[model samples]
Structures are given as structure tokens and as C-alpha cells.
Target: MSPLSALKISLPLAALLLPLSSTLASPPLVDPPAVPIAYSLEEFRSAVRSGGPGKDGIPAIDNPRFQSAEQADGFLDDEDIVIGIYRHGEARAYPQRILVWHEIVNDEFAGEPVSITYCPLTGTALGFERGDTELGVSGKLVNSNLVMYDRATDSEWPQILGVAIDGPLSGKGLEEFRVFWTTWGQWKARHPDTEVLTDQTGYVRNYRRDPYGSYRPLRGYYHPDSRRLFPVMTDDERYPPKSMVLGVRTADGAIAIDKDALREEEVVDVSLNGSQYTVVHDPDLDTGWVFHNPDDIEIEASNLTFNAEGVSGSGLENLEAVNAFEAMWFAWAAFYPETAVYEGGEAL
Candidate 1:
């Protein structure tokens, strides 16, 4: 089927040379609401009609995006970043202004050579297979974001702002795992504590040290606050996101979370102070996101518990995915504080 896999899925140059960047004001096209999630063409041809995972071979590229500093976007480039498109049959649409300006791409579809991703720090758009090699596409970039490999669970993932790098080496790929559950619920409302990976790859993506994006916090990726995921693989096993981040108890008359399967989610900066209840930790690992705060007694229970007095329960989990909001938004006000109120759009 290689004719470039029968092409046809082009929609930007900004939407055919500028007309859909909200008519042209051009700095705010993150409408975000595709989140109800739907993919028919016979459920995306019954999720790739089993032509793959039989593991024949054809992957190659491995550049990048979404390790989350705001959900990912190192402004990568592999040119015209289309990546995968064989028409409604192998459908995969990832365009957040070309993933906020090229953070990753990988390429090919239909002949079945996928790897479409985006990461606006966590606005996620995931897909896999770009390794084992046949010049199919990892079209090879890494320093340029958008890599992600899942060679029959050999597992390798990355993307900076053409999202998808959701915690714990995410390599499930059933109909591309509903596009990684539609960018992992926008990477859990923007990395709400980023953690799913444990030790993925690419020299740990840049391996940890957070000057708050001032450079030095790239490390074995995914830990926005313990929603931790970081496995790009090569025997470099830093795994975790097969599952587990669900540990919430929240307090104040009662506020427990984590039911699973992703219950119609979309929890942006939910706050209520005057009682010092500043809560926003869907997975905000030291500001990776889901913010909002007023300051008082917000007891979101999970793991990283740190306090001085009156109120000491800040450890929420349940992402194991999302995009951050901006150069880490002052670490959600110095470590997972709050402000992520999505009306923006797209979870479908």
C-alpha cells in the first residue's frame, strides 16, 4: 500500500493557508472540546483490522514531544508534520495548530506505519510504532520531539507538544488505544502530577533537575509530580503506566476521586478558599497540572505529602496522563497549586 500509504489527510498550512486559526486572530486556537471521544469508520476499521501486532517489521523514526512542562512542546520540526493519514480508514487527526508548532510527527498510515503525536505540554494526541525500522518513519528526530515506539510491546514513547507521552511507557495500541484515550484526557487536565513512566529512554529524555524549565529538568521523563511515566526503551526499562495512580481521599465534608475508566473526566482548577482549601491535583507533579487555589484545608490524598501545620494532605494521583499550561505556570505556584479551567475543547 506504499504510495506513501495512499496519502490524503492534509488540512493545514493553517487550515489551507490561514482561515481556521479562528478566522485569523491567531494565538488562541485551543478549543479543546473533542473530548466526548468517538471514532467510527467501523470503530476505526475495528482498530486497524488486526493487520499489525503480528510483528512483521517497519518503524524507524523516533523524534519527540509531551514529557510535560505544560504538557509538551519543545517546538520540534520534521517538516510538514502530517505523520499518519490513509483517509477515514486509518484516521488520525492531530492538529493543535500543528501541535502548537511541530513537536513531533513520525509518519504513515494504511500500509500501517503509524506514529502521530502532539504534546502542548499535555494536550496529548498519541499513537505508536516507529521503530524496528524499514524507513517507514521515527523518520528519526528525538532532539526534535515525536518519537514513540511500541514494536509489539518493545515499548518506546515520547512527544513534546504534538502530545502523547502519558505516564508509564504507554504502548497498548488497540485502535491506537483510542488515540491514547484521546490524549490521555488531555494528559489528565494538563499533567496533574505527571507520573506513569519509571525509566523510558533517550538518556532519560534529559533526566531530572527542574529549574522550572530554565533547563535541567528533562531527565528520564514523566514525573510532573508522581503521575510518573518514562520508558523509551532499549532494555532501558523505567516502566509504570500499565496502571496505578488512583489514590485519592480528599477531605472537607467529603471529596474522594479515582473511579477509573476515566469517568467523563475534565477537572480543571477546582477551588474554594476562605477555609484554605486550595485544591488542584489530578496529577500535578510539582506543576505538570490541573490547577486552582485559594489556600486553606485541601486534603487531596495520594503520595507526596508535605506540610507545616493546620493542613497536611497533598498527594493526589490518578493520571498515569496531560498537557501542562505554560513554562510550568510557576510550578503551579511553587509546586502543584492551581488554575486549569478548560472550556477550550476536544476529548473525543
Candidate 2:
């Protein structure tokens, strides 16, 4: 059995060997983002609770391996969900099946270090620039979201907030990038050269099995109406707890666009702190793109393409896009209780 597998079968012995905290010091590797935090640093630290796995229990894939799209087809079904990333001219797909077992992947894009993070409980996948340090699962949870720690300083960061609540880097946020939550088939069709993460993730696991639930049929924990597995800072009853939403956070505040409504309307515009933002649906990827439209550009969507001020293109190619990710409604509301909700092509 592998080392991690050995630990799994011997949890009592493993728990005795692992340390609860780290005392090493290192420079911050991430730059803070301009986003709103609903709670004070202390409040966030106090809200953290053990997620049962313990530190590094659900190991992060530090040195990930990958296979080509054609090779990936041997194991993955067309409907299997994937977190797609296309950056610095490189396209890669991190399969949800693989990530469901390991929550973070320390990766490199065009030589720049980064981390692909996912919180299965909150249904969120986000990318962050990691610089020289690697992020690992802290085996903790806040608002039912994953909490990560940097190996360098052991700072605790709730995945949704992306800011450190404790340790040397407390109150600092990580620079984020957009991660497209798409299907294996959709991603392969769009980027044929993409590399899919392989199951050779150092730690042995049944990559085919998802502990929480399945996303294909949205049953069990992923069902739209299912209750959260853990307690949160706060709750909202306006929408079902597990409903999917495209969440965007900015310096002004946070906003959540209903994914189903965005699909129907194609284009929805909203104002955050007097700044206009346009959200357009990309049918090919089945995702939403949020654009900071301060100048109020008129963007029209047709089929699989978008036209913004006479510049037409596929996806958000012609327009600048902001960092946005798919998250559960309850998780978003818990982190940003005052966040504005947009549904039915209008602000609710």
C-alpha cells in the first residue's frame, strides 16, 4: 500500500505522528486581491472547525501528472465534470473525479507556480498564483468550505474567502484566476490539446468514487435542494442551499448570478457600487463570464458567440473577463451575507 493509504488504514497512529501547527517562516508568495470580507479576521479564525480529515489527511497533489485528452478518454466519461484552465497558452483539465479525492493541485503554467483548489462541500473550484510555496489541505472547514495552509507559514485560508484568517499571513488574500467548471467532453471539444490530470497522484485512491455525491445527476449532497453537510456562519432561504451560482467578489462587495437564469437570458447586467458589470452565458462551456463594464458596453449574446460594441467573438475572447467561479448559493451567502443576488436577468 502507498504511504497515504497506509495512513488511511492506521488513522490513530498517523494522528499521533502529525503535528498540529508549523513554526517555519517564509515570505508571502501570494498578492492580496481587491475583495470584500464580511467578517473581521478574528471572527473568521474563531469560526473554523475541524473537518475530520485532520491536517494533510486529504493530501494535496504537489507534483501532479497528466495525460493527453485522447488518453484520458479511456477512463473518463463524456459527462464527467472537469475544472478547465487555459493560461499562458497552455490548456489543462483537472478532472473532478481526481480533485474530489485531493482538493488541491500544485501546478505550473508557463513556468509560473500556481494552485488549483477545490472545495467539494461548497462546489467551488478556483485557481491562485502560488509563487514559490505550495498550499495544502489544513483539514479544517469554515462555512462548510475547505481551509488551506501554506507549507511555508501554515496560514489558514478558507477556500471561498481566499484570505488568511490566522498565522503569519493573516488578513492577506491570494491573487485568483478564472477556472472554468466544464465537462470533460466540452473541454476536449473546445481545447483539443488539453492535458487531463491522471490518477498517478502519488496518493492511492479510487478516483472513480466521489465521497460527497455525483455531479452528473446532481443527487445526494449535490442535489439542488439538499442541506449543507456542515454548519455555516449564516444561512439564506431565498434559494435552495445547493443551488449553483456564478459568484463574483470585488472591492465594492460581492454578487451572485443565478446560473439557470443566466442560461435563459444569455446576458445580464447589474450595478455594484455604481459600477456596471455584464454577465454573459457561454453555451459551449456551460459557464458564465463576468466583465467589468465601467464604460457600459452593450454586449449581446447569440448562440455560442457574443457581440460587444460591434466586436464579435466566441466566449469572452474580445472582452476582458474578471475572476469568477461556480459556487453553491448557501456557501456564497455564508461568506458574503450582504451579497447582492441577481436572477431572472435582474437584481433581486
Candidate 3:
């Protein structure tokens, strides 16, 4: 079946096309006092052409169940990947095994409503504050990233961008939280008291196997040399499509620091648009974090540690955190085509 036609099999015929086309084409000339759509029909169609199982083909875990780290030891292996979040003195780990299927987890953390999302296709894991709203999979893929929708406004939010592209809340961006993509063993080593998401989800599925492939075994779509499953808006040959990077963006522009290069350098200082920022890699956890250098602190090559509290070492204290996330090179380049790439700590 054609990509467009295949979408109809799982989505309501009207829901699959009409709303998206109308929202993208143009808002009524009359002032409805609502936020105007942020993108054009061509842009919307370019990103959201095909549809998966309508809304919630893969159900989100709303009332998530968790177990102690020690209790989760049996199912999760040491090298299994997970997204770790620590806030307000609370810590939680969302395993990739679970996220690969649900895509989104609407839950509360540290008494605040947050959405933990992962798109296996693009290798992007993000956390966002929902405020009074909740997020779910819209069954749409834009630039090979998951498209999310809010329960309150029903606006579509492409996960990587974190902004509402359609519906009443268009142009609104969700508040993001820091979520680290790391191995289960590394996370447990740092946050021993962390609560791990359990597999007792209401929906029944094969939790033992992943649809995309295994990261530990490095098989299927996740293999280093595997090609992207879907077409992206743009393709840049500067980096491999599946190459991982610590991506950061500002009003001026976006920058992607090669994760592998960061690991080699351990600490790389970057300057973008006259603002200095430091990208530090934690060798132990195999994760990277970016912090704005308001004081122009000179970071040296050393063993670094980054947490919600910020990076370690002198002169780097109290640095404001820059919103950043780990993403595949292709997805980052697709959304920010003009982005500058940081290769071996130098802009290339």
C-alpha cells in the first residue's frame, strides 16, 4: 500500500489528513484570538506525510508502576540502556525496553507532572514538564522522530522540537527537563535509590524483545551501519545519519557536538554566537551534558561529572543550564539544517 493509504488503515480517514491539511494550509483570516499555526502545509506535509496507528497505536503508560532498583535486577541487564531523570531529590529510570514500545510515558516526578519520551527510530529521549496537560504518541513520524500530542490542547508536538506545530496550542513550546541517556548499570551506580519502571503495564506485549532491535547486541536498525528507516527532511553528509551527538540550540542557532569526539576529549569548550558553553563527557556513564559559560570559565581536559546540579570542577559553579538533548545526527540536522557541527571540539 502507498504510505498515505497505509496510514488510513490505522487512523481515522479524516483524522489522518483533514485536520493536518487545514491546520497547515492557513488559519482563518478572522481573528479567533488563538495561536496561529507555526508551519505551512508544505512543511507539515513534508514531516507528517505518513501515519502509524492513529492516536496511541502504542499506549502510553499514564499511571506507571515502578520497582526498587534491586527488585529490577532480574529483568534488566547491566548494559541495557535507560533514560535517567533526577529532580527535587527524586530519581527514576525509564528503560529503553519499555519506551521502545510506548514511546511516551505520562507520569509525575518529584510532585510535578512530566512526560518521558523516547523515539527508537531517531534515538532521541526527552523529558518535558506537562504542566496541567499530558502527552501521547500521535502515531506520526516527522524527520523519523515521534510526533506527540497534548491531552489538553490536542496540539501535535514533534518530540525533537518540543513545540506544538498544529491545533489550538500551535507555536507553544513545552518546558523541557534534563534526562540522561545511559546504561542501566551506570544509572544504578549513580542513583542507587532510583526507581526503575516495571513491565507490569496494563497493555500486554512482548517486553523481552524489541521491535526495532537490541542495543546491547547492537542488531537490526540500531546497528552502527544500518540505514534510517524513514526519510528525513534533510540529509547532511558531514556526519553519519546514525551518529550520536549532544545537541544544543539557542535563538541564534543550533550546534551538535559529536558524542564520540566529546568522549575522546573528555571536556570540550564551545563558543556559539559569542556565548561560551562547555560540553562535558562522563566516561563512566557514557553521557554528555552542556552548560552555558556565563563567566567564560576555562574548562580543562579532565574526568568530569554532570548532574542536574551542573558540572563539576572550579569556576563552573552556578552556571546556567542550557537545554540540550542527545539525538541522532540526521534528526538534529533535519530540524536545524543550518546547524554548525562541533567536530573534536572545533566548529567544522
Candidate 4:
């Protein structure tokens, strides 16, 4: 028999003999539900037109290995970027050096299943709860963001929106957990006891180098001037296409706070569709967070802390928290066309 045919036949036999975890290990290929047209065929084709590699082309790290902070010191550089997640007292860091190859890391933190996703193209790192389902890279890009597929229902979820735009779970959104996008130095300093994801992932990949580019001396697609690799559905020029912004979505509407603007102003209070919100930047960590400002609290930037409760100060009480993420201008604008941009003094 031909090697291809023999391998194909052997796969089923191997699956029958081995456990499901070993046989159908990859989430993308495991128990995919029947395909259903969730959006207009034309729209789906438009999304497909902004093509990427086939399924599993950029593999998802299903089973990951981790190391202690002391062990991670040998490999991680101070300037290296990492997505830090802290849940229920457990902290872990997923380095960009590794995530560039595996766009998704199916991991568990504090007994809760979480999918840590990084799209090098868009420079976005997000976390979502997998619940009873598993998520994998569909090897697709919509608006330059990674399109993930759920194993249980075969629904397509765009990383930026965290909502299923296609398939069985169309219109459904996954619950998100906050992830800190910061430098290794900052993360390690904050969480000294953190566990770091090691290069011991089952897949054979070059974990040291990033295919997109380096963030230290930014080059390749990550360069400040680098143009987008794919076309977006729409474009806006309020800020540079590559400008990084802290974007927040609420039931009323969405807003994008320019990172540079926030760095200058430190704190921005804006109203989105009559609901007030505050965006505060942390210079030490080079990170930001948004919080609901129902009382129109007068924020003191120097004393501000973007904590989970809200932007807290010495005298001010904690406010309600709002979900926000840092994303490139073009990517955020493409997904949320009506999004308002926040300049330094006032939201523009």
C-alpha cells in the first residue's frame, strides 16, 4: 500500500487503540461539529479571502509545560514581553517568544480552563474561558486578528471581539479574563513567585526567535511603521494604523484610548453614550486599564492604580471595573467602526 494511504488507514486504527486524548489530541481536529453557515456566504468568503494557512498551520499549544520563576531567569530577558495572568492567587507568564509560533495556549489556571491567545500580526494578546469547550486556531485571520474554532460546536471566534461570528455558536461571546501585557521585567517584579511557560511544549519549534519581529528593537511586522499584511473591512485615520490603543466595549458602545495620549495625560475620563468611564495608564508597567465612572470621580493621576476594583487613589473608593484591552488602531477600528477615540484632554 502507498505510504499516504497506509498512514490514512492506520490513523483510524491508531485512534481506536489509543485514548481520545492521545489520538485526537489537537483541539482543531477533535470532534468538529457539522458545518453550518453562520453568516452570509459572501461575508464568509470575504473573511476567507483575507486568508492564512490551513487548519493547524499555526498550531495551538494544547498541552503546555511550565517552569518556576527562578528557572525562567536563565532564558528570559528583561525587555522581553509576556502575557501575565493571575487568577485565584496563581500567576503564569506566556512569553511572546513562544506565542508567536503557537497562537493559542490551552491552559488551566487555578482550576479554571483558560485559553491564552496571541496574534502576532495584530500585536494582541487576550484570554478567554474555554468552559466545557476547547479552542484552537482555525488558521484563519479576520481583520488581521486570529480566528479561533471551538471543538465542541465548531464556531468561529475572532480574537479581538471574543464573539463567535460564524458557525453553531454564532453571536455567542466567551467570558474573558484580564491579562496583563507587560515586559518580563515588570511581570517578574510584580509576581516574583509566578510560573513561566517553558519551551518544553510537545511541539518542535524555535521558541527563542519571533517570526514576526523583535519588540526590543522593533522590526519586521512589529516595526512602528510596518503596514498591515492583510486588508481590513474598513479603515480610519484618526490615529496611525499601527498606533496602540486601550480599547473598551460596553453595552452602550465602544471606545479606543490612544496609548501615547494616555501616557501624556496619564488619566482620561470619557463618556461613551452617556455612561462615563476612566482610562488610567501605569507608567511603571507600561500598561493601562478602564473602569466605569458612575460617580464622575475626580481622578488624581499620580496616585492612581488600575486595580481590579477600579482606578483607586489614597482617598477615593474603588469604582466598578470595565473590560478593556490594548490593540492596534487599525484592528480596533476595523472591528468597532463607531468607536470613539480618546485624545489627551478630552475624548475626540
Q: Estimate each model's TM-score.
A: 0.22, 0.89, 0.85, 0.86
Q: Put down candidate 4 lDDT per residue, 165-279, tens digits, no spaces.
A: 7776666567777887888888888788889999988777888888777788877777767789888877887766777788888776778887778888887889988988877
Candidate 3 per-residue lDDT over residues 7-101, each given as its tens digit: 55755775665555444322112222121233453595557845567777768888899999999899899899999888888889999998888
Per-candidate total of colliding backbone pairs: 102, 0, 0, 0
**Looking at candidate 3, what is the lDDT of residue 295?**
72
lDDT tens per residue, model 1, 81-105: 2222223343333433333333334
Q: Per-residue lDDT for 98-149 in model 2, tens only?
A: 9988899999999988899999999999998777678899999999999998
Superposed Cα deviation of residue 277, candidate 1 (Å): 17
Candidate number with greatest lDDT: 2
Please list the residue runs of candidate 3 whose C-alpha ends up more than 4 Å from where it truly belongs after superposition. Answer: 1-42, 301-310
lDDT of each: 0.28, 0.84, 0.77, 0.76
**Which candidate, 1 or 4, has the higher lDDT?**
4
Root-mean-square deviation of every model: 19.6, 4.8, 6.8, 5.4
Q: What is candidate 3's CA lDDT for residue 278?
A: 82
**Which residue pairs collide in model 3, if any?**
none
Sequence-dependent TM-score of model 3: 0.85
Better candidate number, 2 or 3, judged by TM-score: 2
